[model samples]
Target: MNIKSLLLGSAAALAVVSGAQAADAIVAAEPEPVEYVRVCDAYGTGYFYIPGTETCLKIEGYIRFQVDVGPDESGPSSWDAFTRGQVQFTAKSDTEYGPLTGVIVLQANADNATFQDTILDSAYLDIAGFRAGLFYSWWDDGLSGETDDIGSPVTLHNSIRYQYESGDFYAGISVDELEDSPFYNGETPNNVGVAVGLGGKAGAFSYQVTAGYDTDNEAGAVRAMGTVAVGPGTFGLAAVWASDPGAYYNAAEWAIAAEYAIQATDKLKITPGAQWYGNYGVVNGATDADFGSDDAWKVGLTVDYQITDNFYAKATVNYLDGDDIDDVTTGYFRLQRAF
Candidate 1:
């Protein structure tokens, strides 16, 4: 070959080798992928997080099935027949923002239109001691009175809330609206209220008081509840008082509940509880107050077993008495697996 052609070929080979080396260097300098941690707020109010991170995401929920053996056996009997509750799908996210910590939640239920319709249960943004968004009403725990029998009280309402901590005492205040359904016309505009709660714990005893108001109609209520651990068991009591000037028969009502939990074994727990309420105007009108006054009572027993950190089984039986109303009985058996 000619010298000029050989020189040109040599230069081309060198340029190709340089181009390949440059591509290799670029690949080596690529940014590493970020690793993230997950967080979840499941099984009610507790929040859990994964290790080694500031940002976390968690998913949790459960399913429940109920069997009813009412006063008449021939009246109704079958599987997928009685009343099947919905499955809850809840997610939580936690992160740090400058000097503040932020938490957000999204929860909903599946299959049951009676309770929820893939709703935004809690769409709140919380940071430090303040929160604002859509969430559960502050005064609702006692006013709902649904008892988790057929529905959940996780009503997503608009609200703004604040929490403060001092020493061992913690307090919170919230202003929000909630569903006053099955009473006063379910179509009524959201009822507004202000809720206040205070809680403190020392040793084995913990107590909390939750109260609220809706001044427009002289409608307001309050709740006081506490729990104590005694020996191998725990006991709790709650009382609620509410008044609705808009009602006719009885304008006021109150409810009291007591519960006891005993750990029969390391994996087994038994909880027995009872609740009594009087002057439940709405429910009174719905059921037959035909046999007695507007008084109602319920007795319940729940057994739970934790097979593992991710698996559990729960069975519950509730006997509700509205006096003269068929003595509604609800029993639930549920098995849940967590991820």
Candidate 2:
């Protein structure tokens, strides 16, 4: 009787323990899906985040320098260095009211007294299509194409901009601040501009028109640009005009540019372009007059080779047509990384 009872009790206990172990194994074997961060590379300084998560912050930027050689052949030759190292933080959080977005961008090229030392490039807020704070002017919305540069040979400016888009049509309004001076009085003048753009499979075309008044002068202008893709090659055109030139009286400025590129191989790309600048007036003997000869133009050619997806070498030459016109040749080697 003792042996049978002991054996039965031991078997019952073993069965209970086996059932508990099986339950634990089943729980441990179940797999759960992993969450991943979302990365967007379509826009400037792409963003990163966890999918379906709240606004995640992202930072991206680049550094570049170039060596310049004067075109006078015997003229002074030196290395010109420039850099744009920026960390742009952005967030887009969903709220019961709606979606809100914020951005802060800071950049520099060492320190100099030429202009403001710490140039706050961009800081702004956006809700849907409405935007407010310092931003790019509508007249230069096309500037995005040259993201590598603040605004081409020039740096960026602060302005209040509003943007909206529907289908293939887009438009925006930008109100900017103009420096104060005798012509602009001691008060900063407000300048406003509007932009309209159309994009489709054939490529994209955008035009911007602006008008505003300062203390003692009025300014207005129009600019148009387009891009076309031909097989593996691409071409682009840009035209600009202004009525009240700041340097010349009643001076009108106009420019035209075109570029073509081809992939000679998997690692090499060659782009050649020419630009023309025409002016209407000049400041001669303290008086503003139509000098006609004051008009200027520029032409450039570039060749770039990709050592790897993140590294590249480029060479460029530019010819300027003006009173002190000079040819400029530049070479650059750069490395980049992305996350």
lDDT string, candidate 1, 1-339, tens digits: 699999999999999999888784534566877655443444234444555544334344444443433445334542222322233333334436422333344434443345444444456666777878876653444311223221113335577889887877889988766545223422344566577888889888887787666533345566677788977888877776665422111222677888778888999888888887675434433332211346778888888889898678777777887744557776656666654
- List ranges where model 2 is wrong by over 4 Å: 1-53, 68-77, 96-98, 111-118, 141-155, 180-216, 246-252, 280-292, 323-339
Relative to the unseen true structure, what is the Cα RMSD of model 1?
7.2
Q: How close is candidate 2 to the true structure, as a TM-score?
A: 0.65
Report residue 121 deviation for candidate 2 (angstroms): 1.7
Q: What TM-score do all the candidates reach, one by one?
A: 0.66, 0.65
Would you list the clashing residue pairs of candidate 2?
37-50, 38-49
lDDT of 2 by residue, 166-239 (tens): 66566665544543211322223344333333333333443343333332334444555666666676766766
Candidate 1 residue pairs in backbone clash: 38-57, 39-57, 39-58
Q: How does candidate 1 score on lDDT? A: 0.58
